[model samples]
Target: MTKVNVYVTLRESVVDPQGIAAKDALHKLGFDEVGNVRIGRLIELELSGTQAEIEERVKKMCEVLLVNKVIEDYSFEIGEVAGK
Candidate 1:
């Protein structure tokens, strides 16, 4: 089995309202050290395939559904899970 960790985040040009709200709330709570904040998503998938096959499938998955190409950018890491 292959473990895929997908990280999806808004593009730099896009505004993140959730992140802004969280920052504001943190400041109000006295955690004022918080700077510019951005919100994102992490998708963990366990797939059965060889590394190359998994990579191809994951790329397709991201392009087809997992990520929004217009405003979001994504990256993924492929790894092995021991004793699976």
Candidate 2:
């Protein structure tokens, strides 16, 4: 099995309501040092395939369903499973 770590974030120009809310909440909690907190998602997928194949498939998956290309950006890391 291979593990793919997909990280998805909003484009810098896009406004993130969730991120803003969280930052505001943090500030209310006395965390004034936190600034411009941008929210993102981490998607982990496990599959069996060669590294190249896995990367190709995951990239397609990102383009099709895992990311919103118009407002978001993404990056991924692929690696072998620890015990597989």
Candidate 3:
């Protein structure tokens, strides 16, 4: 079995409205030192498969449905849990 960790976020060139909002809120809360905030999604998936299989599956998921490559960026890692 393997555990996969996936992350999706807007590319640096893309504008993030929610991030802007958070930055503003931080300023209002007296955290003027906060410059920018970026938003992203993290997904954890457990699968009964080898590490290579998990990588392939997550790669396909990222390319086909989880993310839009043109405007966003995504990365994932696969790992085994201890002795399992």
Candidate 4:
């Protein structure tokens, strides 16, 4: 089997209001040393399919449902797992 790791984050040019808000909230909550906070999504999948097939399916999923391409960018890594 293989394990795929996906990371999704906002593009550099995009303004992340949520991140700013989180930083502010953290400051008020006594974490004054905190700086910018950028939030992202991570996903892991275990598949028994071939690498090529998995890549194709993952690309489709990213374009259709996993990410908002207009505002975010994503990268993924796939590797064989030690066990089923």
| Clash count of each predicted structure | 0, 0, 0, 0
> Between the candidate structures 1 and 3, which one is better when assessed by TM-score?
1
Query: What is candidate 1's lDDT per residue for 2-68, written digit by digit as tens?
Result: 7899999999999999999999999999998999999999999998888889899999999999999
Lowest lDDT sum, 10 consecutive residues, model 2, at: 75-84
- Cα error, candidate 3, residue 41 (Å): 0.8
What clash pairs does model 4 have?
Answer: none
Ranking by lDDT: 1, 2, 4, 3
Give the C-alpha miss distance for residue 75 in model 4, angstroms.
0.8
Question: Which regions in candidate 3 have their CA more than 4 angstroms from the true location?
Answer: 82-84
lDDT of each: 0.93, 0.93, 0.85, 0.89
Model 2 misplaced regions, further than 4 Å: none
In candidate 4, what are the lDDT values of residues 1-84, reduced to their tens digit? 789989999998999988999999999999998977998889887776788998998888899999999999999988777496
